[model samples]
Target: MGKKSGKQNKLIPESHFRLTHPSVSPASPIVDTHTHLASTFELYRHKYPAGDYTTVFDFVRGLYVPAGVQDIVDVWCEAPVRPLWREFADSAVTEEGRRDLWGGMGYWFVMGVHPHQASEYTDAVEADILEAMAHPRCVGWGEMGLDYHYDNSPRPVQQEVFARQLRCAVRLGKPLTIHTREAEEDTERILKAEVPKDHKIHIHCFTDSPAFAQRLLDWFPNLYIGITGVITYSTNTDTSTTVRNMFAVPASSPPPRLRIVLETDAPYMVPAPIYADPAFVAPDAKGKKLPICHSGMVPWTAGFVADLLPRGEGEGEGAEGWDAARVMTVARENARAVYGV
Candidate 1:
């Protein structure tokens, strides 16, 4: 809208947010609807130690498969990170003895500029993103929206760029993945006014209020909630309430018919046990051990989410992992419907 702005995503230091409630068990394969493979070690290693894996490729192989990850969409939130993701995927194929992503856990991705770096948008960047839209591996547009929390980019610029990308997604015949934080009213208003409700869209790492969740689901029949590891912790009251009350309990109204999808939003947030487990943490730990998450952790998040869902809906009620498996199944199905890959 105005002069382009610039601020590297702290995650990508190099690139990348929250979820309401959260799952997976090994029983059901999962699709990590959103995550980031673009990496940087020096910036965040001190406070948030993701891991010291060889390449992003090796990271996924060594971590995700063991955690039960079956598929993942490694999201790139900006231009720099976008190419980085493709490079990793390409390298995995061309490099000798390179790690396969996760056996059956295939790789897919979405590319777009994030709202945090909204001010940095330029005509050249937009053209690059649009071109990437046609890429076979590129399934959607985003990790773009508004982040009033930081307002790294001015509000007006954020709105303009978000609107622009919405049109771009429609033009490219693809869906959109959004990241909206602390700007619920504007987020809803924009999506309602601009993007079609039936359009394929993923509210990646959703962590708004229960009403917000319902409104989004009510408004967008095709939308799916992106659940993440943050739900595993107790401090995220907003996310916890949104998940429990909106979908899990369904006290006020039936939970959003739009199914939920799982994600790692990796290299930032790892799932429960690894996120908070003492075993994963060093006794002399100064910060979280595996704050940098990977697809491997999706199953754990899926499993955790399954545990939170209303019990007994699935067969084998009270069975050890049946319900969780059912939840993961729902996540996988939802992801397929939206991504169509």
Candidate 2:
């Protein structure tokens, strides 16, 4: 994505798309199950240096708060965990701190070394993660799993680090936030071996096959699939297919409770709906896309998923089908279920 122009063309709501459709109730606050707040803020600064928001708190309040985003699980997955994480985590400990720092949004986090940085994983790194796990705002361990697509680290090292992280998370009784891509076999094998069936697991930003998702769902009763803006992309058939398979069950069978949670995975996966919205279109008609994604944009992703749902079946009914509010409600419940945030 190109850097945003220095010229301020529109207000925040117009520049960044918000769900104005009546079907999406503003009362149903958004709960972002996964995102990268620090990285997203840095990108925001780069893209719009002279823009309205300066501090991360201001950025979040200006963009996310107005859109009714209530809770967020920011991810801290890297080697040599950033010291700023402590500041962010510590700031969310008290209600006053949360109100002052995150604009009254519930801010929680997960920490671990991502598989791309697996080769850098060491005892010190693991110890730092363990220390964070004890913090009141730290919710889980991961975004750690195998990634055969990039294989930035040696495959064996990735596997070893993944298993190691899994063991630590499981031993500590923490929820698992997994990141698996193009390595379904190893991910499944390792998870089945290392994790308990009833452990709360979140398969973040799932882009894998429906069969793999079904297998994981069948194996782990407490597991929930993470749906991001990627679901709105035409190329990502697997994510939509997985959602369809989960919700489009036989009518004879009771409608399966949605085992899915919504996330932005911000600074990435800006939903397609934003591009289509006239409000976000450049005045010059350049079709410039939003340079960054954030928690507030999750409603568009929810609307996309709601479109894929079977009509007149699940929660809240609308003429078109399941209301986006219902999608938000279900996803919010699933987030609380899996992460307890």
Candidate 3:
């Protein structure tokens, strides 16, 4: 199910990129804790391979590494993508697959039935999901909460499946990445009731209010807010509270207090530095101009996030400042902790 193909890409080198500054050597490499790795790679659909690596790994090795990205956690959030995920995971370990799929980058996975497709969730589907979770490559369970904004699936069905999947994650001892939108109250309720204490959870691309962010962070110590390129947008449609949280522990305040991680939600949330307007682009080789989003944009995102963070007073590392390097380091470490990598 993870097979990716499309002639959407650029035959460029790290030197040609303008998204990064050249001074930082081995700058804090990033870990895009959440992304659709395969989907995003194909989304770029490079015109030609950036280097000698095979086509599939081109986006990662060519793009992300150059931009200071180190790892990724690909989330398979729909029912039908499981088989593809299996294929991708299988391909990741082979020598040829290494050249083709990873090009030496490290990645992990999480899979689940999203709330949009809640109607399709069932006992069989649940069993299959759990079985897939057993894969060595699988590290967590989710992108599986409620999305009341669209209500693509009935609220009732969504809740039922949400709770069901929560139980499954808990049963399997895997961390969770819940996707809750416009249903914060219900999400909080379900999380409080269904998820056990100390379970690792991430609210993907959070755009809620600061109060909501504080409430959940206090409730779940291990909970993390999945920040994305959305924060870089001057006018965020969802009004992410992460912008607030980032500045909370005032540089004049104390230690870096929030558990925040960066992600691209690729093929969707493109960082401003890399995102071009509709008229700013042209179609790819296949007569398709794919959206501009990928793990490669993460460095820009990290820089954007660093600019927003409070320059908490102190000398070095822990003394939170607008240090992009520090932020990137924390994010990488947090992802490893979350996925137990």
Candidate number of the best TM-score: 2
Task: Give the C-alpha miss distance for residue 159 in model 1, angstroms.
Answer: 0.4
List runs of model 2 lying over 4 Å from the truth.
Answer: 1-14, 17-27, 250-254, 281-286, 314-321
TM-score of candidate 2 against the unseen true structure: 0.91
How big is the positional error of residue 321 in model 1, measured in Å on the Cα after superposition? 9.4
User: Rank order by lDDT, top first?
Assistant: 2, 3, 1
Model 3, TM vs. native: 0.81
* lDDT value, residue 227 of candidate 1: 86
lDDT value for model 2: 0.86
User: 1-341, model 2: which lDDT tens digit per residue?
Assistant: 13333444422433453344344454677899999999999988876677778898988777787778889999999998889999998988999988887889889999998999999999999999999999999999988998999999999999999999999999999999999999999999999999999999999999999999999998999999999999998899999989888865665865477789999999899888866766655465345667678888888898899888888755422323676788888888889898887
lDDT leader: 2
Report the lDDT of model 2 for residue 321.
60
Q: For each candidate, what is the lDDT?
A: 0.67, 0.86, 0.72
